[model samples]
Target: MVSTNPYNDFLKECQMALQNSIATLHLSIPAISFSLDAPPSPEFGELTSTISFEIGKKIKQQPRSLAKQIVSSIDVKDFPLMSAAKFAGTGYINFYANFAELSKITIDSTLALNDAYGHVQTEKPKNVIVEHTSANPISPINIGKARNPILGDALARILAARGHAVFRHFYIDDVGRQTAVVAYGYKKLGRPSLKEKPDHEIGLIYTLTSCIIEIIRLKLALEKQRNVSTEIKQKLQMQLEDWSSIAAELKGKHPRLFTELLEKISEDKDTENLINKLNQAYEAGEEEAKGLVREVCQLSLDGIKETLTNAEIFFDSWDWESEFTWNSDVTKTLKALKKTGYAFQEGPVLEFDADKVAEDYKLKHMLGIKDDHEIPSLTLTRADGTTLYTTRDIPYSLWKFRKADKVINVVGMEQKLPQQQLKLALWALGYANHAKNLTHFAHNLVTLPGYKMSSRRGRYITFDEVMKEAVKRAREEVEKRSPQLSKEEKERISRIVGIGALKYALIEVDPTKRVVFTWDRVINFERNSAPYIQYSYARSRSILRRVKETPKKFDYSLLTKPLEHDIIWELARYPEVFIISAENFKPNTIADHANLLADKFNSFYTAFPVIKAKPEALSEARLGLVKAVSIVLRNSLSLLGIIAPEKM
Candidate 1:
């Protein structure tokens, strides 16, 4: 009836035996905190502990001699799931599990828990907020920017499974200059109805408008430099070349849109000033600016929502950045910092002395800053009195802390400095606890081969486009494998397989590592991909369906092969894996565990004949093992926000 992890349970037994032996020997040593590690290879043993060396050092005895004495004194037969405990190497104590008994415990617990097989609930749960994927509303999310939402959603799933109340938030950045320019383009074009995806249209308009504006700015600078020094003229000429190249590329991509926008933007002498005014007005909540920018942002968000929903990603709340500025949160936060002497005025602009605050509070070590490091002061506002993005984010961070115990900002690695500054700003306002609890879960980028993505030039693949291609590729594979399936069934399977492949590929790699994404890697059925795992699950289910009979009881002793033992060991470690992934905010751990379990299960399938064994008792037990494997695989995939189809 115990729901505790079997692997941890076994470790506890080992630790208790060691503790008792130390007491009987009267060994004088400080309380030891040590860990047990799996041997490098199965030849060593299932679990190995090096506590003997530490204890021997303290007692002034040789490690091997101490290990021998401990082994002779301890009774290996006393352990429930361990068959033998012996000394190896210098002082390592290797413990081998009694696979017969271990298999029974693993299979029974998995079947009993079913969908809740690996998750462990905490006694003290917390309310957590995870903010991610707040991509600008100017364009659809491209593959390069897809990692943020995928990682965030996976983290949220793991936390909820661990019994935390989680809230997923997306901060809509509609008050930025990029959005203001996009809005200007939309308004200049008479706010025409989108003939294609709303975001795609917005992206086209943004690129055309940007290209034209650059050409105009460069021309004016070149005209002014005609009588200047040769050095200055060369610099201006280089700038013009860069803008001209971009203009050429933009024109080639969208000829008609570029020509129309060029004519319109060229005729307007104050286009640059107008965009700047719109940005400032939006921040100040002017009715005209608010109506125009919000309308453009809303249209783009409609397209974004469609793509995310297709990927099965949803948010609990959509927070607007402008709301914080409009609701006086930014104003109040600045005033509080000024009172604490952290805020000061540099000319007409406001700034925060982050380095001084860290020195005064003795927070260098806690903030991960070296003693010789010099932190720069952060600019809070422009000379025109408009607050910066990070300044607004400070108020938003405080708002999140009001409803949650911890806040995780899943931002890109390039924003490390800004994220750190935000935390320090919180500490400056005397919210040290909040600052300490704030985590910047930074992730690297994703790239495709031979292709570079640039939103400014409107040269990027949207998430919707990627999903469509994946599904089309998956459907072809599914049809080739299961030609007899109905059209409806094939479609269903293809959708699950396609989306699963995309999600798994994004998450299977470490977040700190860059992913060179390729369809071959994502859709591979051989190893380490979602399809491989899904197919393994389906094979298990296929076995169950063929048997056509359930065993009232199973014999664990029948499952004693090496491959079987490997599967049982991997299954027993699921709870530990789940707990570690949640604690570290790394969903790749879950992905790794799933792929490993599937590999072991597939090996077991090839090595043994289940449902066709000579002895009925062995066949029934193997069937029970397959059922457990299927349950654990499904549970593991769910943690990564993937579906395990029975007919992939």
Candidate 2:
């Protein structure tokens, strides 16, 4: 990789040395992974690996002999890549780059790429949908909710930038029991909160209703402990029943009000009647259901607009599930599945041999049911002959197949089972003819250290609150640092720095790991944090701000500092960082690169002066170096969905 990486021509010679060694020893290791490694001390080279040990194992020989055999085969025509090939203990081979060559390449390539620094071609732009930030319809997005969306959205940006066809789907888990709780509270004691406008209003009502449920629970708990009369307890029980019934009815009326309702009632017989009632309401132009659906749709649209506009996250289209179940489409899909024997009518309900059909699905393991388990007696049609959610989704998956070559679902890991089952059921129903193209991009939840964020229990943090706190904190930091800065500049910096810190903190970790929100780490100014990277960028800009002359030519010969070489090497690998981030669906790679670059650059900045130097040529070269670093830092930070403020 370093050999092909334009900046390091010496890498080609190093690669040839390794290759020639393989050839001379009559050993044929196809390729070696060239990497940067840190040894216990400086006695070891800057970069090294134990490739010799791996080769030894393959050839069935002692590691020492193999290391010697490989070392003897190396050819150093110009400068030696490493000081000496040493067989440390059990067959470990270590190599280091010549300082002069490494420095030249690092500086030259960084200056050469400029803003277009990190562009790399992908193997193939496989259609991927990194479904993330799939928050429930509990309330507005929170700090925890921000992690998935920002991570997914940034990954999509990096992948698409690298020539991958990435489709980012912000999954809204609107149909569940969680929504049912909100609907129940709304029906009983809560009024619609119109402050958030359409969608926000629903979130507000859900939040308040959740709080109301807690109060009711507490009251009931206390009443049970008291020495109350039997009649009073009975009356309280009746009221509780009434509340539960109202909640159930409300859930039936508005599916989005509770996400868990769909999971619970997905296979229930009552689903058909519910769907029939919903469709009847749709057909007769029943004002209430239609009004509610429209209102919810509006809320979703409004929220999408707000987040996308304010946060710069955009979606090309809102693919609606109901639209796919249009009269002709649903009828045609059902008929086709039935003809294919994927769907069969049995005892007035439609059933599919899901267990027998799972062999073809890669997500089979994710599906809750096993091969021996009876194909779930899925209710496609109720006793009253009404279509269910599965009926709607089968056609919906089919519709996605028809529209795109691949479908990527950005959803939370909690829904892994349902998503898996849904995919399997789709194939069994014959709707998902191109089922192989589907991908469920699942991510772990972001939880507080001591508590879980539950919308049902009304125990959750709002995104707005997190943003406000971040900005407020950033403002305080800025004022403390520069009391002379105007209020306007402080506000501007606060927004960028605060939001940038939040986004960076979230993206800096693997998506599979649960995010524990910690303000200390998130807002920290030192070590592997957003402010650290931002400060580096700002420091580079600050250097340029004090300079007047723009150097037409950089004296690459003068750039031989160890710190400079390290920074340049990190900068030269920006393209690779982005490639890894996109390929793995992890934006943390970019975040890591930024931190590495900043660390190296900070060392370089402190050791050598860029703006003030004795030698004119060396000063110009160092200034050119800082400019290159700035370009890369900006690019890398932007990839992580973070802002690079010139001054923070």
Candidate 3:
């Protein structure tokens, strides 16, 4: 598949002529990847590469001699983009970018693509499953929980725009123990019937339990004294009663594996056979355990729906882990793994074979792993013969693999190890084809002020709260600026722009970097942020409002100014940015690019009055610039899962 990239084709042709010149002059060197170089002033040439040093090393000759030899073979007509070549003492080859060619190429490329300006259909699109924002059974969707879904959803949108079929999945960890605490409270504590506000109810329970647990820890620390008073011990016993009561209620609802730990803590006794007991119950189709899990699972799903709605995140698929237990294909996968010896039956745990580790350190290094490192042991089935989360995932992974050429798991970095292990386990079990295409799109944590967000205790902000705050602030700003605007109009624009700003702010940072949520930065109408881009788009619309001219069909020829050229350049680069962002799981790159384009357009607007310019030459050119800006801005924001309001 030797495909020609449109941008690179012209550069390759130019490089070929340079290569021929070097050969004709008997200079030992090839053209390198060179675009442009400039000093503080324009006196320096427009393009630069280090050909002199390369040739000097090859020919055992002075770089100056090689430089002279190469330039002597140049035919001016063959290298029209280059006015002259000059080599600095350090073997630098500098050539100027021809202004005439730059103008023609820039405008020509922009006009050719038109509305399809920045997109390149690089490959046949395939279905992509992006599973993200699988936060624990927490009551609130905090600022920290907000990062993954925003990035994952944004990436999904970008991939889909580039012709890939994208399916977004938002998984909820209902089976996990953290949610168990809340469930346990409901069952054992005679809790309030607050299913209508389940998240809030759970949130309150978790908060109270957490405070009590801390006090219990402090009392336990005091008990380390040589002699403990009976009075103090009795008080500790009372506290333990409170803890047990809460844990029992939560456990009665969720029946989580970790509930046994809470049980041991309350009883002050270790149960060594806890896993065995639980596994036996699970395998025997214990109605109580299954019923509890199912009930809590349903509640968690309800909470998830509200959370996502509040966060403005949507999913194409909400796969249930329980679905795989009854799936015949899951058994087939387990059998295949056993046959391949990728998974061997230990007394209780199913372990991945150590012999399967790839000896090729280079390959491991490429996958960002250190030497002698291997994925952790995977337990597909318990000793009692019930399927675990890993087993359930296998069928889902297999389905995704067969459906698409690639499958992306947009999960937290904490799950990176498990993700790698899952892939290895799946591959060992005869899901080799799917394993090869799996990608773990890991992202860093989103931290609140002075603390990391924890869903287990419900000690975080809810997604609804974040949106509400943004909308409130936005409404006030709208009223201050546009008081005459209708209430309905203000509300509509507020939600769109405010929510758009929040999503973009979270996404503008590299997903792998920890994000510190801040109201000022998110709503800042300044550089490298969502508001700046939105404001830029709105400013362009405002300029067009004066012309009273319906946006005409675009004519790129009128876009002649340097500012116009700059905006066009950025707009043309959109497709490349989209491809890179999707490939690298980096929405920040797209955000940054959009920011740059807006900044350039703003600069252009300041220098040139679009509406006030001559009707034929300036008006057409300005109109074209504004139209292009509007299209690119809307498209960029759309990729971030944001809607652009025309009037905002």
Candidate 4:
């Protein structure tokens, strides 16, 4: 059978009817294409169009009169799914669906498509790359940075469903000063074996090492200020006091490790210079520096991989930031920028003239820069010839585009300026097409209630910790609900529900919105939560299993009640929802749709009895409806990186 979109069918009918109306009235049709929006309330109709108002103004006629004319020209009998077309609210034309026909079409299509009910393959597909969750390997993944991977994974899933060749990437930032600091601490401790998870162990060393280094640097500055002005001496004292407070805090958390690192670091007078040297050597491909940094980063990444695997997050490629530097990609990028007249020398450093490029290319609007706004030049290299992060990112962006038509960087909102600068650098280097195709999928931070997390201070909750807690909480709830289930079954159910709840909570909110994540909200089984929808699906399956009867034929006309109509309407619109969500890169739409669909299905379950219906035809139709809802709920959840559990 050929696949079809029921909503798209309705849209085509409306467009064709409007064209016919224009021909019948001998009126010139305006070139403006208007949208058909669903009415605010079901009482108004299923689909409402306000195009008559625009057309009326064009033809010098009143809107109400034009609407009546258009309504008169539409023969509702000619449409298969529409029952009537009428004018309402001054100029809006509302078209009501023929529920019996629509219900039949929806059920038939759903039963035929099964798992492929909502997804559609685009005729024109492009190779797309989604790079996200490139968090620094110094610490474990936390809830604050969890949004990037969740959103990126959902986008990759949706685009692949839409027939795009999607590639998921995690750009390992192992070449920066942060990694060097962690590696420095590890080496100072004689590369001790981790007594705990590698990430947690490495994080403690990083934070403790950072604290001691700051104290040393501040004390040295104070000693040098002994002969300076009193004002300068006072400023240096304030800085030293701040570091003293951080040192105290670190000592309280990890006293043994802090004391050891402090003794080891204090013995060396040039610890800061050593870290800087390690950073530069790593970038310059020094084997010793490369080996040590990679070893530390790999240990942290091993723990990260375990956490991601538990959460069902995986990547197609793990791109290393150091690879680009070592392969001369950064050097080639600098040479290209210099040849484009966009790169200039500022003393010993090189800077990209971002403001000049934005103005020269007239990219103010495209780059979200206002005419009165002043963007500063971006430094490409330091005085000592060390490249900046954004400078390396330019080459990485080009590398990503080499294999894909579009590249989306799922970075945080705080990095919007740098992402914009990366794109601008691409434009200045004469790769305007690559610049245009680059996407900055910026997302806001996640906040836990009453707690502020800081990775630098080793005060954040790791992703593994959150997942473990979610499962533990879910286990309690599962036991309370189904105490008779075997231990193995309960554990399995808890794992699925727990992971589903976390993934759902993360992706259900808009990317631009901040999520105050809490256990109460994540594991909610009542309203607007993953467990609620999963329970609904399980309930549907239970009903079908109990009946043990297959509906070889369904009499769709029997499903005419208001609740049935609601379910049918939503089921028919599932394909359209999938299309809009994928095309717009909005997974929240699918999440919202799943909740609404579950609500309708539950209402129908309460208001009507399928198995006890007096007429066998009605029972079969209701069974068909239940099956369709189950299929749709599962498909919708899958789009959001969630699994619809068979049993809750």
Candidate 5:
């Protein structure tokens, strides 16, 4: 076996052994590649191949004879990792591993490499960029929007581990009407000192200001409705009642904020026009507008960074969406697209001909869609000459490609269509290579049972609040489980356990599936949760701490049990699993593999003793296995941006 990739080396040796057998048998067969994989059961040895079955159909010979000849002619001496080659049933050759040598190589290599045990290096490393968590600057990040940063950070970590120059980024979507409305609300409320976290305070200001301004507009509309139809009047009346109720609710929760915003906003005669002017000025690079909006955004972002830091999610850059606009990147992008003849005027608004580009490029099937499937054109700007969200994203995408060979945007599943449009727009602008390298890492939403979150109504749970509650609950669990620990020790472990549980819950599910989050599922210590893996690691450390010395010359031959073999195989295959996870952009693969390893480790320790085994050599060998498992666990958790606690 190779030093680092023991399983992969075994696989390569299996193929070579087969070729050697065929050559010795004196059979002339054409060059054919065979797929070698683990058999259905462990009793069939380590790996099984059915290439003889395919060869039988092509050669029109007796497969049973061929199988017998190959097994009899195989020389086990040539492959040190193979103990024997057995011809199981018909047309099947199974190979058993030499566990003694395999175990020594796997465990020793694992301990030697330690932290970098499973980080297999890729031959072609890339300069990759990951942008995510571009939440609207109007409100604090809610639980539903929290998946982006966690997944994005994990992706960057995984790629970096695989020898890629990866960069994590957060795109601040503050160049839109949402930011304008929030800034307007902040200004109307006298830009008061924050009464809570900056994001929370800004959210309250935005919600109250929006609700009140809506009510005012509705009331004014109702006043001017003379001789209107009865049905129209009823609809208007219902709408006014809804806004009034929303305003009342806001006032009930924040009386001072509501009163302050109402008094200040009512003083402006044309509040809607003022907001539009602010939006236009902000996009046009006006000083007063930029100063006012950027101040509130920066404050809110500071609070956002605090929440992300608590979860150990950090970024290399925080790219402002407004900067692209101010630096003329958006203008240059628009002009470039226009020159490509894909940009056309649809009345007073501008539109990009996406379908025409797809048709011209003949990329419908290449895009995994049918030829008849029509793509709707993307709106570039409004009638008032203000750019849309995706229009601004075009320039931002170009900016990212300038600094990277590949760009991955971690966004929600709902934005799949818009992302497709963004890519098509890039291609239409003659950035075909950039479009090819771009990826939309789309993920589904996170939902708590019995709760529907709406940012506009301020009816959602904040990430900060969730982290605090998770930690508090974790502390209770820690106290119940280990009451003798010191307060500081318990506090430290609780933070690690709590934050790890939250992140695991978000990332364990497949990215295409919605996560139904609940505390019972997240903090469970007995199942496939982060706490389970962390506890298993802690238990391994506990055994080593009690022993207090490294074992000299562990007897690898003594590890003969099925559970030990299972663990050895898993530890050996970890590097391959990591490569699959990184190449496929799936963090859940690592999570899944970690849970399985933890399960097997627990089962082994439960059935076999590590420190109290009959002979000292056997005890030391088991300890070696335990240490290897612990190292892999710590590395896997680190890739997920999770901490492995030593005493949780």
Candidate 6:
């Protein structure tokens, strides 16, 4: 079970040949570590090294002349992986791969590796914990929050494929003000039997609780300020009127449920105080508060789980945020931070001195913040003794470090400051190594074309609805193009295409850029999409099916076309591409490579004949090439958690 990367083999040979050439020519240079990378274009050769450009200045000669001199000293016969070495364009040393040997070995290795084609093992595999998709359990997951799980899932898959022991974690943020509000409304409604989707039902309660309480409070204030200024009276009246409109809208949608909650909430003497009690009790681990909140949280979680499972996303562990507080881990971490003299009290609030810690450790530059910029102190606990989410995360982070060597938190970019402060907290608590190993895998936002998402307004689209729309649109596309397929097959293919389309839409773009989720781009069959790549893979499969056994007298050297060479080089580079994707925490790199390879394969298939070529040996070689493309495409897609369907 030897894993072979033909691209690396060629790269190494090129590097060795360059090193030997430098030695053979009696050049006096410093000891150098040799490496080669892909040139800007395929015509430049399979790989390029700029050593001559580096040393030409040192040795006082023109770069092109130095490169030409070095090329003549190397004998290609010694390094069979490389066919030729030459000076290309003003100083660059380029190496041409022997595709005749590369194609044979690349295709043969691909066929042998099969499912494990692109996994290149590292010398030091780590226990990596990826915590992601920690969406609040007060409601169903929305489209705005969908990107986290998809990117997180793809990252875990890539890391695991690359031979790391990867664990996926979902942090259930159950102990929070939002959950307390929803639980309060649910309790007042007698915790009625949920008829609608559990999360949607809970969400209605949350919205109702929020609006009704606001309206009630505003009215009470207006009543008390009867003799106040006209401006103050008008301000209170306007807020009351706004909540009234929102309540009316909710009442129109679910009259019975809204009426029930509104009646019970209006009956309560101090509803806001009750919610505060619930929040504090839950954070304190009171049994009554725990039962009520956990019940509502579990119901919401069940609905969320269904949505994620639809997208084929799952987690290895569901870590409870409250568990840290209950087990006194948060208290322990606070004590440890206090010993470092960075903890101080401001009135009733306790805060961590993140700025002082950064200055003390000289970490402003390493943490990527300017020395002139002040790192804001973090609030550890509120006046009411309830810890903040980031405070709870401190102990949870400690828990994760106990299990793994590295931890990657896939969170939104908006939490950048909080993440930085958490890292400094680790250093303050004497876990500086863990702080160094922690990564904030921050991603940009996802925006719809003409829509804005606001969770508090209850106007956000759910992930479940978007997934259904995608599947429906895919079915139409599948029916229009592949009418010959049976109904069941069409349904299955539609799901595969739709799901893969959504995943690729979120994943193909660089994480630093916002994803513009548009239908035309997502379901595009022409280019740069999952369906296009998937179809190209299917075309290869169909071609292979049309051919019989490969002729024993095949000549891989017949694949001499530019497009053929491109696909061959691409097939050989899958392992290198895979390793890059895994190490850099960028699954988009794999998506980009797969799309490029598919485009090349499609172009080659259109211009060249595979099954009906004149020579039997050439046709056999072409079929072998098609098979190699299929394997690599499927393997790359798998690393992104995409299914490569064999048919349209």
TM-score of each: 0.97, 0.79, 0.80, 0.97, 0.94, 0.94
Candidate 2 local lDDT, 368-438, one digit each (tens): 45555554544555454545555655666666665566676666777665565567767765545456567
lDDT (10s digit) by residue, model 1, range 111-169? 88888888988787999999989988888999889888889999989999999999999
lDDT against the true structure, each candidate: 0.86, 0.64, 0.65, 0.87, 0.87, 0.87
lDDT per residue as tens, model 3, 1-648? 111122343345446655787767766445553343333334554445566677678768787777666666765567544446665655665554443444345444554455455555657778788777766554655677778778888888778777788888765554433444455444444444565556655565555445444445645655764286677677676766765665565556556523533443355322223323433443344676556555655665677677677656788877665455444666777787788766777888676563364332133554566667764577777555666666666777887776677888888888776676677666566555677789888888778768886654445776777788888878887788789889999998888777877888888777788877677766654567676788888888888777766444434456666667567556545666777776666778888888898899889988887777765655765676677677778778888887777776
**Each model's number of backbone clashes?**
0, 20, 7, 0, 0, 0
List model 6 lDDT by residue over 329-376, tens digit each. Answer: 999998888889999999999999999999999999999999999999
**Model 1 regions lying over 4 Å from their true place:** 224-226, 230-236, 448-452
* Worst window of 10 by summed lDDT in candidate 3: 1-10
C-alpha lDDT of residue 129 in model 2: 55
Of 3 and 5, which scores higher on TM-score?
A: 5
lDDT of 3 at 590: 80
RMSD of 3: 6.3
Which regions of candidate 3 fall more than 4 Å away from where they truly are?
Answer: 1-13, 16-20, 23-47, 61-115, 176-182, 188-197, 202-292, 328-332, 342-347, 354-356, 359-363, 379-388, 548-561
What residue pairs are clashing in model 4? none
TM-score-best of 2 and 3: 3
Rank order (by lDDT, best first): 6, 5, 4, 1, 3, 2
In terms of TM-score, how similar is model 3 to the real structure?
A: 0.80
State how far residue 284 of model 6 sits from its true place (Å): 1.5
The residue pairs that clash in candidate 1, if any, are: none
